[model samples]
Target chain A: METTHRSVVDAQDTFTMAREQALIEAAQAGDKQAYRQLYDRYVGRVHALSYRLTADQGLAEDATQEVFIQLWRKLDNYNAKSKFSTWLHSVTANITVSYMRKQRGWVHRMFNIEGSAAEHHTAEGSAGDVDLEAYIVRLPERARMVFVLHAIEGYRHEEIANMLNMAVGSSKAQFHRAKHLLKEWMGYTDE
Target chain B: MSKFEQQLNQQLHDLAKEKAPQRDLWRGIELGIEHQHDTGTVPQNRHRRLAAVAASVALVVSLSWYGIQQTSVPATDHPTGQALVKALSNQHEQQKQALLVQYTDAPAMTENWEAQLAELDEAASAIKAALKEDPNNGALLRMLQQVHQQQITLIERVHAPQWQQI
Candidate 1:
């Protein structure tokens, strides 16, 4: 029975892959309707990823828009060597990072103003609902980015270092800092 | 992992599954794509205008060439319109070559942009060969000018600063 179920699952996966490949081809051929169908399919996940990375609802929305626009422009670059969803995730991650960098001006970066700003913003948004996501948003900028990319997105420290242009050790350290802060906020002890 | 860590991980997984943007984001994405599409056409429209201008110049030059031939005028009576067309074509060629040299090491956005440029060059060469056979062929002259315009546009587009960003 287990073997039969596995085969059936494999067949469904193949069918879904074939359907997505056709959609990608049609979208690449300037079919806006086909592209819209793709948007409907991926928008929720993409928006969630963007929100986690940027930790701001407004910025996440902007990043989501930028991601789709970049995707449309670079559709022909997709070679299908990997799953379409994987490629889309990589694209979204890169665009979100770049968008965050652009939004964080030199003054904000130099002064490290985003932590307080993000905390205040999150507090305002999460009036009665204090959640893990709200705490994640209150993390310092670099720590938040490292946590999201590494912990949430499943990227290794080496990959995060390259993506963020930081040393691998720094990526590890930031992730540790993120965890320590989260634990402290949640009142978790070593015991 | 500790129990706390496991709890945190599960919470994150649940958050990913349950969270979504408050608004329908497709509308913003559609607007952004439309804006990008509009900006993207600026280069093509510029190419069309260039081709139109080149055709006008070709038409005037061809008319002068025909007039001189019909009147049976002396060679020195008017400046050679053929020489003028050749000079204009040479001028465009020189500009295109300069652009090529300027962007020799610059990366192109599209993988097949060079192939597209080569195809335009081949079309221009074919038209030039036909023009040589019938020196005063007005249609061939116009086509050659249009092809030259296309070549300039292609080279400029592939080497555009924005392409490097892409």
Candidate 2:
């Protein structure tokens, strides 16, 4: 629970952004110390997203490690046009999703033998007691991925469709499915 | 949108964006990156190092046994050239078996290594025969040692071609 956010102090935005770009440049030139500074600044954000998407802490930890390892090699691909955070978040999301998909076969075969309920996670706490994070993990797998990408991470339906390799309609359907299930679980029946 | 829907949207926006994992993850990241870069070399280099030590140990044992046998010979009695050849041949056979067993799994660069070894063995036999006529000749004994050394060197090279000269 490292709390990091963009500066509320708009006056410092220019200087902060410049320093960030300088750090990125140094890291791209193979400065591991600079890369580490980037890692410290960004790891928490990456971990949170990874955990939300995978719903498994160990998998999230692995995905987070892979993200930075991939970043070190692909640093040069950072065109620096958009914010580096935006670019890196996409990278993190892609790697985490890919990691999950690699396990998808095992998940698929398991569900074939057992019902989907066996694979589905349910938060033990009552709706009022449990936090949203617990509830997020309880959604159906594809729906959870869709909702986390679209609602929480702020990727649009089209972007999520592309990310998840589904039709745009399918992405929206899954998001609606996720939102509907979550609202029902949280005791918000009135729409 | 319903008030609840808007509330949910706001909650999603306000959701914690950063969650620190229970453990530090940088060490693993560093190792992963370094390991990828050294994927072919690191473990292979370690295996080579281990094999080099084993080869050296085998050679040392063989030479030590040879030394003990040499000392066991009575200084007053003139040990025949055949006796010295027998000792050298026995040590070479042991060393060759050890070297071949160590390198069985590895590939040898030269296909005709056995033939080359046969030629060296033939040369050693000829040198031993010549030694029969001249048991006291220093040059013949030196030549016999040289032939054995060449065979060992050849075995080492063929098995571990990347090995640096010892």
Candidate 3:
């Protein structure tokens, strides 16, 4: 059954791979149509990642636009060594983290926002609103990024480290710190 | 690290698995791209209209100049050069207008590529600077490496051989 499922998935994967290749080729050749098709394919995932990072829908939308624009121009560089999604995720992660860093500086400069450890997470809301995302967003910026990519995105620490430009140890530490912070904030006395 | 972490991971995954955003941006993106392509080419009617206007003006000026020359008018006083210069100026203005249309219609094609590249450069620079501030910034270093790899790949693409159409 797994083989049958695998075969089906593989067939779908093959189709997707072919489509990605065609789009990349066209985009590299400066075919705006192909570039737009590719953007349509991944814009949501990128936007979701951005939203998770920034915790602001508006910022996420802006970052999503910015990231895709970057991806379109940089499509020439994508060699088929790894999956295009992985390369895209790397770009998304880098862009979002960069945006977060800039936001941190901006917020600090514009307003005297200081780093604090205590956060009161509300658990009583719609499933969409009161969820792990809210908790993840409350993590310190770097740790939150690591947590989202690793725990959420299922990337290994090494991959997370590479994507975030952090040490594996730091990535691991951040994930733990994020989890601990979440657990504390949610008042998970059962744990 | 614990069952709590495991649960947290599951919860995070569930949150992430929410439906992706609507693909309306795709339509906007496609329109933007088409607009760029349209602007890149000169509209035939506009070009032809300008050409006809210039020709008509030149015809009138030539008729007047011929009449003046027949009257033994000084050649230097003739506005032939000025009229030709004005026609040339009009042609330049038409070209400029076409360029402006191309630019305004599809701004992404006009300026976003460089802006994206500059953004990537700034990202790379930030990672490097962060690394400098904390030499053991493994996360920052790893990100820098990815950025470096990406930057190199982009440069290669920009310099890559253009594909030939059959």
Best model per lDDT = 2
lDDT of 1 at B160: 71
Give per-residue CA lDDT, model 1, range B14-53, as digits (tens): 7754256665556545645654654343245354555676
lDDT of each: 0.72, 0.72, 0.58
Residue lDDT tens for model 1, A1-191 = 99999999999999988988899999999899999998888888888888878887766877787788779989999999988888888898999998878655543656567554443332232212337887887888889989988988889999999999999999999999888777656656552
Of the true contacts between chains A and B, what fraction does model 1 have? 0.48
Q: Look at candidate 2 and tell me the lDDT of residue A146.
A: 93
Native interface contacts kept by each candidate, as a fraction = 0.48, 0.74, 0.24
User: How well does each candidate superpose onto the true structure, as a TM-score?
Assistant: 0.59, 0.61, 0.53
Question: Model 3 Cα RMSD, Å?
Answer: 21.9
lDDT of 3 by residue, B52-161 (tens): 65456545544554455458555453254334334433543454455445444332323244554465567656544544444322233334434433433333333333
lDDT of 3 at A136: 64
Q: Per-candidate DockQ versus the true complex?
A: 0.18, 0.27, 0.11
Q: After superposition, how far is residue A140 of candidate 1 from its true place, in Å?
A: 1.5
- In Å, residue B126's CA in model 2 sits off its true spot by 52
Backbone clashes in each candidate structure, one number apiece? 0, 1, 10
Q: For candidate 3, what TM-score does chain B get against the true chain B?
A: 0.30
lDDT of 3 by residue, A3-116 (tens): 999999999999989988988888889887787777767777888888776765655765675576556656778898989988888788788777666545644555565333
